[model samples]
Target: MRGFDTILVVDWSAAEGVRRAERDSIWIGAVRDGMAEKPRPMPTRREAETWLADRIGSEIAAGRRVMAAFDFPFGYPAGFAEAVTGASDPLRLWDWLAERIEDDARGRNNRFEVAADLNRLFPGTGPFWGKPHRDRFPDIPYHGRSRDGHGMAEKRACEVASGASSSVWQLFFNPTVGSQALMGLPMLSRLRRIEGLAVWPFEPVDDAPAVLAEIWPGLIEQAVRGREGIRDMQQVARLAWAFSRLSTAELTDMMDVDAPEEGWILGAGHGPRLTELAMTAPDPMADPPPAARAPLEPPPLSNDCFALPPGVHWTPVDEALDLLRARLSPVAGRETVPAVGADGRILAADAVARRANPPGANSAVDGYGFAHEATGAGPQHLPLIAGRAAAGAPLAGAVPRGQAVRILTGALIPEGVDTVVLEEDTRTDGTAIAFNGPVKRGANTRRAGEDVDAGAVLLPAGHALRPADLALLAATGVAEVEVFRRLRVGVLSTGDELGAPGVDPDPAVTYDANRPMLLALAARWGHEPVDLGHCADDRDALRAVLDGAGTDVIVTSGGASAGDEDHVSALLGETGSLAAWRIALKPGRPLALGIWKGRPVFGVPGNPVAAFTCALIFARPALSLLAGGGWRAPLAMTVPAGFAKRKKAGRREFLRARLRDGRAEVFASEGSGRISGLAWAEGFVELPDGPAEIAPGDPVRFLPYAGFGL
Candidate 1:
């Protein structure tokens, strides 16, 4: 039913050196056309990357769609992207780390040092910790747990869900998994960027032909019910064999989970469901949803006033973005415009070079043109040619023997000339030029097609054009460009107590903050923000405004929570669909995600602080998706706390704070209604997903408002 025809599974490792006999070397297993292939093992990570690339490329060439799963977390904790790369996009984090990590074909590596470098970027000791080998890194510990002077001692959501999966920060400790993440992520980054390969949950569905997701071998181990295998390769083979045997319907359902940012483990809660569905054959005539499909039905809502809705699960912040990402499809309208006028537009299709980079051999430097062998090994003088060749002009005849042409930079090399002598190295008279240096053949010239070959892709779809990219388009002779239509976002505000900012205020009313803020933010991010204006708690008035707005997506700032005045929920329940509400977040718990009249509707909390937080955390990424730019997690950095604080367990919290003298200082109050707190604070310091006490120097994740496009 789906497109995938070949499935590849990798049991990844971070061990260094030739590991042919080592038990932890990388192992690869594949399934094609119901056949289980023998698992292959590689002694080094380099060889493993090469092998998988070749195999996947070959399968694609044969007209078979492939699904590749690797055993590693595709992303770090949510704030990681903003802190490390100063961008909210998670893929940028991958590219940043990939550029820094060095992997050789041999087994040698510096994974420990890499982890230490990453840890140093945060405040205090971590977000990443546990270094058992050396005491060189003062922030990291040589044990599994964090001490009073260190970071939080907890696992990520997916790690805890796996039951037996190790923490990604444990490097060289009791359970050493830190190396795998530090080393493996770089390779995963390389794999994700492959032309036709797409990394699952992170890359938008339209980015690639095949999807790559995270896999946990423990899921297979459970599926087989602890079947014994002589070696890890044998175990991998068993896993691949099991995957190959699943029916198309079962496999499709298993991979249908919403996992946009923090990837879902395939066969994870659905092992039993898959087994049950496998017995029923899929109808060939009924077309199934494509890969990376969104949930079709709204999850049930709970009747409780302030708690989570019934059957509505509270996903991790990053995982929630993934869900929103699935429901969003890029806007389809496109326009062709002159390349010079397409500066900040998203490319609607790939741009290919029509001609080669250098139509012929051209000089790289300004020098005398001559054949190197024509002169002896020592410095020699040659007669000056009759003509001079400038960058745009060329000499019509070839250089004669014992003669050289006076050439300028970028000029095509004359026939019979293989090298160029620098003008500074030669003394030229009226008829003769004296060479003062030994000349090398084939030097100072750029060969044809050296920079860019004809028919090569210069840019891909969804690329936002930059100044340099415009220059490149000019160089490629691209006169007209195709780009996606600009996204039109509608901003709505609902509350009886709110008034417009510019007008004279009523005695009992507050100036409407959410609409103006969201409008300014949308405009700043290059979207056309349509102000749908404000409505009281009246549902009919809200519906009237929404009907007339006629924008691609809608964002409302009040009436999303569980109060009698919360008409946004009632309206959506009557005429639209409500997907989720009451996320497990502090100051922003009462958020809602749904669809209205076939368009996505995001409901922000009534309190200005919560409204701002929800808009930044949720609405921003959703709009980015519709703009064809894909999802981006807000950037978060680890900074030391300048003040002490304690919070209850279970709920994630964001404390408005300012960075001062290398530490994050929280605002005096935690009330969500304080509008000045949002103004006074430069960013937010995030508490973990449980009860925690923060000392004056504890490391807290600092999320700058700028990272969210505020």
Candidate 2:
């Protein structure tokens, strides 16, 4: 009463008394003015029936709408059983039971007398009631029973009808008791009649507070409050709580209830509890979060920032690729030129044919050729007229009828001649020619422009020259082509301890590995690599080398760090400007970016391993940008761990590893300075910065050499 506006507690055993109690509860709780007073409960089934009849009669007399909840099962049980058994008529089974009860109670004086009397009045027909017990009811044969019964059967009819009509009544069973009862016998049979009601097998109840807390706090609270004013309120409250708890998704699923929408408000209060319920409700229609967003910043240019010691750079590999794509996008233009044999390069513009292939009609092979009339229909020997028609020669004269003329391969076919007899198929007889076989019309003739027309387009713009393209262009008389300018990249190694290969080694110095590596790398990308030689640990010397490099990009190694002998950073600071330094990464953290003499300069760390890793990670993207090409790193794969280690988060780390037993195993010495570790490594394992340590059995992402721009 304190919580709900109206509450109805159904009690079918004492229908009249329960109805009165429900009416009183509703009357006491009503606050609205001019509301009709709730009626008292009828004390017995007879009284309840009389009250219903009287209420309906009064409603009809007054012309008013009357609504009420009943305690009968209605047709629900039969409907339920019909659905389960796929039967056409489940009520027949109920009638069969009624008949059996009546036959057993015919003379017996007991409570079953009512049940037995009802059965005889409703003898079942149809497949649902297997041939009614003939011997038991021998006096009343099974053949002539009515579908709805009569006389003594009419009493049984009430009970049979009660089983179905009683369905509407079970709604008030103490939730627990009602649920169990509905799961069994007569009530179950009645439930089967309700259209589209799904019922699952009942499960035993358990007192799980966590589950109760999540599912039914509202019901529990209501039941607790109901105890203050009602008899057996605690029992009802517990039953309500159990029923609410049992209303699980699995049960609702069987009931065909749609899951609640996610993020929807539930209940009337605005607090954490209400929010929790709303959040916990299953959401079959919830939409996924929007796809992860990318930065709106334009792709970084080579001269954007310089990496110095202690500065943070946040560009990811994807961003780097985007920058390269932006810088390397192609410009629109076209040009056309000669392409013959292997000389055809990519066409810069559409080319129109200047002349047709096969300049004039001619013979395709050598033979004594003439019109069919000149050779005649019958086999006859004829004079061989002397007339030459080579590739560039015209026929001397038309042959007379019954006479043949001499012609060579690729010679023009004489006018008025439609065929040529091969020399192998002819013989000389008394200075005359004789054909051994018949010649077809248009034989051995090459027509002008058979392959292409003079005004047609020979090749379109942007077509890469292939061998066949070359031949076609040559045949079409195309002579020149325009193409994109090749990109040039300047390669330089920075460090007093570094020297070029083949140079005498200084015990304290090492040969410059970055130069040769960069050269080969640049060449692979279609750029001309200019070697600027090695720069000593002098700022002026490095600048002088950079000034004269004249390359679109300047890549240097060994002087990016802030060490005492490291001069690349000082050189960049004094000569030009630094863009960014020291990205949030391990191993190859010391990186320098800046512009020198209007050219982009990247100072990679000097350690052999570090330099190579940084080149693959950073320089490759920068180079792609300079060369007018897009960049993309290969994909990473998940592999089993080969060893164990600890790592910190916030910075990305890479370790040299090898595939072993189908798993990626880390090298013994993973230090960046250990070149041998890299040499022995087949790939790299990426480690995210975190407090969690990786164990031997932990799975990790392995980046094979192919994935790292190798």
In terms of TM-score, the best-performing candidate is 1
Output the lDDT of residue 629, model 2: 32
Residue pairs that clash (backbone atoms under 3 angstroms), model 1:
17-107, 82-635, 83-636, 123-638, 201-260, 301-310, 302-309, 302-310, 649-691
Candidate-wise lDDT, in order: 0.71, 0.48
Give the least accurate 10-residue stretch of model 1, judged by summed lDDT. 297-306
Tens digits of lDDT, candidate 2, 1-710: 00111112222331112233442321111110112122233323333333334333322221122222222222222233233335524344433333332111112212122222333434442111112254542223333332332212211122342221221112122332221122222322333333222222121112110110011123224334434334333322232223222223432332232121100111112223333332332221232222112121223344434433243266544344344334342222223233443232334334557778766667778877677754445565667667656767777777666666777887777866667777777787636787654566677777777666564546533333567766776777766655333446777887667665777666675877778877877676455688888878787776678778876677887778777777777766675576445555667776777777667777878777888777776776556434323233444788878788887666677788889898889888768778888779987888865555888878898888766446
TM-scores, in order shown? 0.60, 0.39
Scored by lDDT, model 1 comes in at: 0.71
For every model shown, the clashing-pair count is: 9, 57
What lDDT does model 2 reach? 0.48
List where candidate 1 sits over 4 angstroms from the true fold: 1-310, 313-315, 358-360
- Report lDDT (Cα) of residue 511, candidate 2: 70
